[model samples]
Target: MTQQDAQTKPLTVDAVMARSGVQFGTSGARGEVVAMTDQVCHAYTTGFLQHLAGLGEFSPGMRVAVAGDLRPSTPRIMAACAQAVRDLGGEPVFCGFVPTPALALYAFGQGIPSLMVTGSHIPADRNGIKFYRPKGEVLKEDEAGMRGQVIATDPALFDDAGMLKAEAPLPEVTEVARSYIQRYVDHFGPQALRGLTIGVYQHSAVGRDVLVEVVEALGGKAVALGRATQFIPVDTEAIRPEDVELAKGWAAEFGFDAIISTDGDSDRPLLADHTGEWLRGDILGVLCARALRAHAVVTPVSSNTVLERSGAFAETDRTRIGSPFVIAAMNAHLAKGEQPVVGYEANGGFLLGTKLGSLEPLPTRDAVLPVLTVIVASRPGKIRDLIEELPPRVTYSDRIQNFATEKSEAIFAKLLEGDKDAQIVRLNEHFGAIAGAVTQLDLTDGIRMTTEQGVIIHLRRSGNAPELRCYSESDTVEQAKAINEQALAIVRDKLA
Candidate 1:
């Protein structure tokens, strides 16, 4: 049957997956919203929470927190989820209009599990749910188990009337944002940010005002600009050159030291230095890892090699491209009595050092800590100075191709087969000798090949968007761009 016809039929978990293309990731679950309706959210959340309840993770009297971003449909989806949690014999606590990290912090602080409704910088129409437990982020295996239950059950078995049972109003939780702001204040001192003029572009960011508050708490002038009630669909992964130029003009006009903004839920950060040049998110991740003086850094293969070369980390572990993978690796290291000083993503969210009295690092992405790292690391000089002190490694990333929703994953799978397709063989040979070793292989998330030339090329599909992402790193910025261009040429010729 056609995809539309299948979707119109009664919604099964399998049907939802097939229709919406929902997939499990390091983050709880993600998929296109066109296939994710209120019914889909209700069914999957109810099934997953019920499964959790069955496992005794939460009892009937236990409370669960719910939060979401500024996306248009977030409220509806969140409501559906909250209702589902209540129906599963849990109390639903609604933390209205908070960033995903804040909600995760609240969940850890309250000693209750939580759920966040967000699409994390995807388009306005897209939305997904992320789950957190007291221990840390939910594991990918756990999510896969939940998905299995969801798909195995009959959609018609859900009690539509029973699911609508009324429950106590969502209780107001104390503002966790204040606590996060205070953490920065306590660590960096209130005067640490003095003399820095920071311009914050508040374009439909759920954490816009909170970011401004953090800036002010640090003793910096926080200028809020481009405040938009309408969704701007800002993608933190791929920023346009024009946006960088615009930020530069704004910094010059306002005499600002830096420009910073967050993705929709304020989980992923976007930053520009004093020169108004937007740094790649992976680069920001490296800088933050360095500032934290992490002994071991956990990041995805999509990250830059400079992370290892910075001399800031004794070891670096690469994982699939997602917060869940990074967080899982960090947790494993911590279990072995090793302190996980920092965990981050090519997207700009940095997980802080996990410790007591410190919030449980949310499995979801976070933008605040990364920006704070840059600000705090400035020390005696402005952020520009820190950038100057770092090695001149440049990384370029862009999503150059689009695929039909179903075909995207298939194309990536084909690339991983590594047959002697002329284009694939040529790229394999060219980049096989760079950096240190040539490994012609497929990692979990995508096709990543390392070379002895100190360059790495990664081609993968965006979990949260409809495009394919290509990442490359080199000694010079221009050279990085050139390599990315060549890689894109190969992808086009092959995927075409």
Candidate 2:
């Protein structure tokens, strides 16, 4: 090696993240797989532990739990986390490929911190590590804390390309897959799903096997279908057209009581009715909370407004987009002594704020709970009936990827300038008019403009990936879909 090369200093965690295109989103740190080199992951983990240590979360010989999804990049990223744990004087407990909530439940039970290597439902090329506190998910405050920490690494451990020179095998770890299964079995009992023919559409999700196990354990005849070996990025928030058609065809041909599935990591749920039409996620959250008898429910502004209009809960709370924001709001409700506090995202990932019976406390998003709860709540009816019972508000969402964040923010800023009348005129000029004039504008997470005719148009940047999302709502489903489709195309062309 050259003398100057030997003297080259290693980059700090923040610097590495900045250069590698990895950054903290609403939930976790995510980036392309190439940017998530072993050294970069190690620096990220080291910074996380340092942040936790600042909060008195770790010490010498302290135990830290680790888990991963089935993504190809997961094992490598986890190995990096294990190495970091070793260097920080902490013991790493390896919990092989499991749902994010399953690992979280085990870690929170042990009163130790844990890290999950999964990108949730994003594309396979992108992945992230979700950090957990002893109590629950790390709040937004914790993300800020990690960003300020200084992380240093040994120069000898990495090559000139910044990748780990040698790979370290995972440590001896416990398998908590059964424990997570037992969690649902104990709470709902063996016959909660009796006489129900649940179709498990097993994609390449990490939780596919677990989904089948839990359903069968509950006396539900789980018919597995479409199990895939390669990872398929199934966005529960934005169900693909083909998936919708397939679920509908299967439900009609197979006579399924319901079709249950989840995203890539099985955090956010995707459920379809007996006739094969998928239900919206916010509706799932409402039904699940109702089943649990939760007096208060927390969700984000992007969720359906039917949560409030339906008058289902004693208290309803809204936050900015993301689980951290929803969980934080749920925490506030807990301080008020609200029992059975539960929260969920627009993607239908349920969070239990407090322990409910045999179910341990898991404040992280879980695809399984909402699936079971919504199915059980449908007692003598169908998933479609439970949804049809709700108010007639329909929501449609779509995104334009690779849309620069600066471009998205700039467009919103420009449209939101001047008077409201001027804004509507500009919008109508660009993409025609919404149903009616703008009556209200919500700037909670993004800019949600509600028209006098009860149409809602929400435009926001995706928290996880590089994209701009548009969510629209109307009394009719077709209009809702059309409104969003039109808006997104306009944004795409304008930005392009």
Candidate 3:
């Protein structure tokens, strides 16, 4: 059966919720396709626009650009959202089948608010909606307000027929993509990457060819490999061992400097060196910051502290682990003329310095910019050599036992109440005594604690998935592994 037919048939709210797993995350709204039907998507999009209009957030004739990734279900979701925008009395400009960064660029170019329908590297069955104000991402409070309106409003109000009647034509605007490509070229300058051969694994990414174009535009040969019809959801944060072998073989055969790829949507990047070792995302972010010699660098708390140790950034700022939080922090710094040259995530996406004058594009996390920095900075040696020259530190991340939605929320709420006496006491008693005192504790994203031995432990329920992620960092690989094991054991005891 077609998606539209399935969505039109009656389904209970409980069933929908069970299927969708709709819950709040560090980003925006996310859920499975079964739960996020055309009806639900239409309602949420309509409500968000209505909320913005009611608050005088957008002008009556203001344009609202929309885009999506290459998800099989994205086309229908995009159509529903377009209709919803029209129903709310805003012009809908459709940039069909583009990356998240592309949509952000389009919105910035049009000087209008926008939205992107994607789930990043999540499973194929999952999807999400990210809203952008003219300035940048929508705030958490604004997201909550929009969700409230969606829940309170009636879905029938945004039916297909009513939406069609309200439809208004939006001018075609593909030049925004070209403009963004040129922005990268201009920032790095022509021939910045002279004499570099880069291999791009185009495994069904929506922006696969775009990545190649950007690389070649900057004076590099891009060897495309592993082109696939089915979407390969690459978690750039965590590259599988098999993919690492494949990348190594390709790099050796092609005699390339580095291998570059992105997740399904091309928002996050994955890179492999000539030696065939997959570079971790956090390492890439730090390396890029070092290359640019950023005056002030902003990153998520989940990132490695290597940036501080590398002496590349004069000041380092940490935010909760999401692009929106990082972007917000970057915007705040720019307002004070701090001129943050770089902002990035542990997931291999880097934001360049803000562009000024004549409706400049806001610097959001992007995969292309970071990949380019890595390529330009590397010497004749493999990418791994450049990484080894840095300070010695190892970071490890793995999810603890998975939990149901209600259970995960309950655990986080308890942690936020500052009942540390009971919680900390029980944790110490369960995990045995350590050598150093609990030097610092933070609850920005989750419960993160550090020890004097240079071991760091961060525990938080995954905002996007059902798992609880526990990250550890130490001076050595073995030490990091031990800390990760101990942290997971402690979590298992507590949750049990």
Candidate 4:
């Protein structure tokens, strides 16, 4: 192509998105980084701003905060985003590398729009950008509105390969990070965790440094563990067996009162009790909501059913497995005039629908809020005691990675095709000998079946990747884990 022609060729959002192979998902526009060329990133950012302008949330000269995870590609993505903001006549306030929620909190405090460039629990090779409106997270409607909007990309800021110039410096780190550090400190009060020894698994999360700061700021002795320079994608929904064991080992070795960590973005938390046992995110969600005395709770259908069985909340709403869905349900409760309404995903990212802690309600999932709430609520007691307060139901989850979405749907169709007898036959054919007969079926976000033997099995396509995820629940932990393993084993066999 001629240089002038190339320069004049307008970079449209649709063409860039189509060529880059990146698409919007549960949270943001997630895809492999190789496909997320600077040109594509810049176009998407402009398109996002264009949508915001229509909503009156954005205008020229307004400052938009930006943050990212520890991934190597994040800097360039942030640079592309910053340049886009500049090109569109808005200023990009680079908040350095901070947790997704931390940056969001700062932006919310400033009452301005913001963007976070991180994949969040996805692999390092992949990344995404989550946009925030002035008040809170972008909803499904916002995403839908942004599509099909064509935006021109500037060629000057990019290299010949359509990548941001590496030498171009990011904005000076802002005080927003420090302000976020003090956010928890001021709310929870100093020395809230005094006399407790906490272990932090510093596994390359963007919030690693700030997590330690929060603990220490609260007068809790913070010990850093598993500090890795390499980015580690910690999936809070599907906890790795190694993380489970490491939580225990670290707690026991250091005689920790609790061990805390988060996924790459620090929006989803991982909490281990003194016994070094990792608590499920749903369980943590339950405790956090009850501690805040929330009147209404919204969660995904795939989460642990124990929260309902415990009668912890006055009302419980279940949505599909996505932040957008959860946020939508919370808004519905607001329409009903419910106060202190809250929501959480199975990943343990807590969302406040109403203002709390002297701050306006941040309508996004937050790891620090839940971490602080659980810690303060379970004060002067063991973390496991909080679990004892809840009903005794166990949950387990696993996934068949690289599994095709079509195959998962076909298998489900075959299972749910026939009447009761035929369905049982098909279930057995796939899951071998499950606990008992299928007594109930729920098709909320995916296929969930309740067995007469008090077992629950759920299967759904991963919204963020090419995988089929399965969730199992039972009265006992061992039974729940067994159900998950047995079900995934069947899937693995079929895929093989």
Candidate 5:
């Protein structure tokens, strides 16, 4: 081999992913922790920086912000990313273990790129990295650009096992938590949450302590509960049964006005009413958007249709299931001169696309905004009161884990075969028993069927894991839950 060839190895992100099995998911690049070696993460971060550099969003000697969740493997992976930043002639500013949006806000304010080390509510054994350009989160196009780049690296930097031979320590923490807290406090005023009693279920979320500080700064009585030593994977989208019971018991014991929590990375939120019933993400989105007086709203197809039924916003749009798609739609609305535009997911991650008064647009999934907005909007009433004011539509969702991606694709292909009429017939034949007579089908993100009785049932494969997700909506919460359960059962039977 030539001397130059030995020193300069050309590697693409696709090649690394093929060999390491750590590929991009719905949001970011994710895989099991075991496969995310130092070399793999370094390559991923380098590719991200390379992509940004190409877009003129990054340059050598520029600063890059980095942060991570509280997962065990986060520190090591973050170290690897920091080393990559240094190796590429950029400075790494460690933001400590803060929420994803906090890091994004700081980086965007500083006009630099950022990377977050988090699996985002997934199991602790698995982890992921979310990349951000200077302006906002990377869209689908940026992801493709990262994958196609041929990164140059020296093989001697990593051992045969892909571990860095000599990894550098992460820099000291640069506190972004204060700014994040102040963002809400300043917007809502110091006494915005005065006279309210809130129970914050702090189950190992990266932003747990920050949540307490924010609540207190807003003059609310914040009761911190359920602080765990070990990492807890809390999926705000799929609230665990134990968490539900815990919220109920806590509410009863404490007589709180509301109970709020966040997922592992603290991007998606979990807000339970005074009675201990957790609100659905789409429901939370609707309430938050209404509270913010948003002129335009964009959400995923799997979200509840109440955004339209509530008649709150001047315009509402639905996109495919993912933040990237939602962000893209929100951007379009902004380009069209829509004021105070916002977007959210079915998982309660609120995204503000346009500046509202003093607050700037973050344009990423945020946990605290929706919870805080909903609580403040409730005022003297409880969280349930704000929920009751919305349209009488309920949505529920659950997933079947360990379901292969190929199997999910096959099911979608079979259901979406032929023309729209033929697709409707297939959907009715499969789900008629549970959903009455299917009248319409929406193939936006997945297969969403609307029955004649105004019931909605949506089936979409999980983009972050090998899970098949089912969502249902109806007039009542009971009916929505029942439909979700029955749909999952039918999908299971089909898989069998």
Candidate 6:
């Protein structure tokens, strides 16, 4: 086709996804950086705007906030997205290299749509674009809407490799960073963390410096450690072995009250206690909810059962594993006029669904809130003391990388072939040696089976990549790890 014809012809989001090998994952559009060319990124941004426009959340000449992580590809992707905003007759407000939540907060406060260029905890070679409506994250329906869009673009704007011929320079950084830091300082008070010594792990996370600022502003002596120049894919759910040792060393060396860090975009958090023991995300969620005095709590089914067993909240709900699902459940309670509703994930990303005294509800995964809350709530005693107060439930998770999704599906199909009794029999046959007889099964998001001995084992395929994840909960940490190891071994052997 001629250039003019190509410029006029519209492209469907699905078609672009197929052609470029970039598709929406659990949270956003993700793929290898090489697959996410300027043309592809532009098309996605345009499609997102088109979908939001239909919902009356976007319009021409309106401002759309944009931000990025510290990945090398992020700036280039952000430029493409910003150009698309201009092409769509909307103004692009570059929020600079800020955390995902900071960009969302700024856009929400201004009542404007926004986009973030990040891959979250993924590797640097891969990246993603997370869309946000004026209020919060786009839901499943919004994803459908974006996927169904047909976006028109000018072919002349891009080169043969789909890169922009002349990339538009990103605008000057807005005051988003300052405002985001102030959000915490103003809410928690300057003396909230008084008499505390905290270590902030600044390992190339986009919000590394921001984390330090928050800790110091809250009146804690902040020590920055292991600042990396390159991107480090730190998965909070499966804490890296090196990170675990580093935290232990830092705790012993610095005598820190607590050590805190975040994933690449700073949405998910990593918090280690004085003993260098990192708290699980679900446990952190429970502590944060208690600290905030939340009445209603929502989280993924993959999280520990301690929340329900602790009797801390008046109501609790579980959903499929993902922020969108947790946010949806939180919104459902809010629609019913539930007060002080909150949500979190198994990755330690806390979401506040209801407004507190001076802090507005963010309703997105946040690292700062939980980092501060858990630390403050642990005061008057060490973090270990807070753990002693909780129930005896412990949860552990691990995954098999490069595992085929088809194989995982086959396993699930075989296991879930018959009724509950038959399914239980199948599960027990596989895990009974380590976990005892399967007593109950919960398939909210994955296969969560409870044994006669009260051990819980859950298995699911990763939404973003070809992998099988296993989770286990038991009365002791050793038992949880053993159950997880046994489950992974069984799955691996079956695949073999």
Task: Give the TM-score (vs. native) of candidate 4.
Answer: 0.93
Kindly report which residue pairs in candidate 6 clash with one another: none
Model 5 — TM-score against the truth?
A: 0.97
Number of clashes in every candidate structure? 11, 0, 0, 0, 0, 0
Q: Model 5 segments beyond 4 Å from truth?
A: 1-9
CA lDDT, candidate 4, residue 313: 80
Model 4: per-residue lDDT, tens digit, 1-496? Answer: 1224336666456656666778888898888888887877887899899999998889999999988999999998998888889888998899988988788889988989999999999888899999998878888888877876666554665676677665545788886778777777788888899999989988989899888999999999999999998998899888888898998888778899989999998999988889888888998999999999999999999899987898878989999998989999999999999988999999999898997766568788888888778878888888888889888898998888878667887777766787766776666666646778776778888778788887999988887777888899998889998999887887677633
- The per-model lDDT (C-alpha) reads 0.72, 0.86, 0.72, 0.85, 0.90, 0.90
Query: What RMSD, rounded to one decimal, does every model reach?
Result: 4.2, 2.2, 4.8, 2.7, 2.2, 1.9
Q: What is the lDDT of candidate 5?
A: 0.90
Candidate 2 residues 99-137, lDDT tens each? 888888889889999999989888899999899988788
| lDDT, candidate 6, 346-397, per-residue tens | 9999999988988998989999999898888887898888878899999999
Q: Mark the regions of model 6 whose C-alpha exceeds 4 Å error after superposition.
A: 1-10
Winner on TM-score (1 vs 6): 6
Clashing pairs in 4: none
Candidate 6 overall lDDT versus native:
0.90
Instruction: Point out where model 1 deviates above 4 Å.
Output: 1-15, 150-174, 356-364, 418-444
Candidate 2 Cα misplacement greater than 4 A, ranges: 1-11, 418-432
Question: How close is every model to the real structure, measured as TM-score?
Answer: 0.87, 0.95, 0.86, 0.93, 0.97, 0.96
Q: Residue pairs in steric clash, candidate 3?
A: none
| Residue-level lDDT for 352 in candidate 3 | 64
RMSD to native, candidate 1: 4.2
TM-score pick, better of 2 and 3: 2
